[model samples]
Target: MDKVFLVAVGIGILSRIIMLNTDQRQYPAQPNILLSQLVLAFVASSLGALLVPALRDRAYTSITFLSLAAEQFRQVRENRRDSLQNLEDIQLVKRGEAFIEEIARTYEIRNYMCIITSLSTIGLYYLIIEELKIAKNTSLMISSIIGLALTLILKKLLKRESIGDIADVEIVKISFVDECIMKVGDLKGITNIGLKSDRERYLSRGIGIEIIPKDKDYTNAGILFDSGQRQTIVYNLYSRLGLYREHDEPAFVPLPRRNPKKESLIIAFIPMEKDEQKIIEAVKSCPVLASAKGKNLSLENYKIGKKGSV
Candidate 1:
């Protein structure tokens, strides 16, 4: 039993530790935050690893601590929300409330996934060793592999699509009318208001992109018009290609809007460098928002009457 417990705890700790150092979204979690998450993962895994022993020993009283962990995870979500909201005030591009909410829930759930993966590993080990009478060492090795595989599978299953996955992205030129109106892609023209220096800086080095949804019903699953998606796109671009620093001027910042006339989304921004392809790559790599993911629109979805959708 001691050997088995040690194996379970080891597997659990290693699995959850992955979350402490990695996040694809580039959420900018500080060092302190990363440390906090590492501690959280340890506690979660410890609880999950000890579950079988607690049950076998009739130490049911300790099981109630899982609920306390649940409450703590909930607080983690709230803390993430607060941290993001504070950052929103300072960020040149805001991540919007919806995106912030999505991120908060994600952090909370990831910890839960670590716990689940640990429990699965421990439970499978017992099933092999105790139920099937497998050798302990063999069971330990097989269970460890299966446990890590389960964590990866759960992570992949939980991921949503990227901007490049569902949309056609085109890097285009930022056009201007009378040096003040900005025409980005095929969308409606925007009026740029910047000082002479800022305008010169933006036009000479800026990048533009046109985002077209592949299908008509993409508003729900791949909505980029929301402030969060737009901010993410710009943040990616700025991080990759560098950003033009004219914060006060509207034209200096990346702006995205829905082209009501053509039903497309367009974004225009000034990068510190003038690499169009890099800009395209950055926008394409931006993560799709959970709320934005929607079912594709099709003839079957709407009433195909003599007219159109009713």
Candidate 2:
């Protein structure tokens, strides 16, 4: 029983710690924040692994501790939201409030997921070796390996979905209007742009893109170009292609504006470093939210997009 708890908790904590830096999901990488998360992961995993054994010994009172942990985990979501909301003020391509809430909620659920994973693996190990009367050492090694493999597999299968899965991305052209905004391609409002110098920079390096949503099972068309998803496209694009921006006069903004009448999306961004294929690749790599991923486009109303479809 002692060895089972130790190995299970140990493996669980180790799994979480290994993923701490890598599992940021666009969050900032502050050491203190990471440390706090690690501490939380440890507690959650410990409680989960311990609960099984504690029950065998008839320690029913230990279950109460879970209620306390649940409260703490709820606070984690609140803290994360407050932190990101504070940062949202300064970001040029901001993650909107909806996106922040979703991310925080995801983080909270992730901690619980770790707890469940640890508990399941260790509990199964206990059942095999002790309850089922398997060889102790052999069960230990085999169960540990299976636990680790399952952990990895779970992580792999639950990865974030990317934009390419739900939408079609393509290179397109839409010229700037008034040097401040492009109102072309059936765009509703002014496509806010920059000064002449800005145009020069954009002319030299910018790549125009068009995003089209495919039709099959869409409930709402607007989700295809939601503000949060647009922000995601901008984030991924900037990370890969970089950009030049001023307070109001910037080089690139990867916002996908709806051409409702024409039924298309237009994106005009000036890469800090000019590369057409890379920009296309970056757009493809944008993370698609669960809220946006499952819904399909309406097939009857729209045609599959083509070159300059708008």
lDDT of 2 by residue, 1-310 (tens): 7887888887777767656644563454578888887888888889889888888899999899889889999999999999988987677667677667767876787787668767877777777877789898778777888878877876777667666665677776555655566543445343555567766655566667776665621323455667676676776676566666755754455566776654556777767776778777777666666665434444334344433323
For each candidate, what TM-score against the reference?
0.86, 0.81
lDDT by residue (1-310, candidate 1, tens digit) is 6666666666666655655444644465667877787788778877888887788778999779889989999999999999888987677666678768877987888778767877887788888988899998899788888988887787678766777875677887666677677777666466565567665665677667777766544353236666667676666666667666646655566767776654457777776677777766777777787765453445434421224664
* RMSD in angstroms between candidate 2 and the native structure over all alpha carbons: 4.3
Residue 47 lDDT (model 1): 80
Query: What TM-score would you give candidate 2 relative to the actual structure?
Result: 0.81
lDDT score for residue 55 of model 1: 80
Clash count per candidate: 8, 5
Compute the lDDT for candidate 1.
Answer: 0.71
Per-residue lDDT, model 1, residue 290, is 70
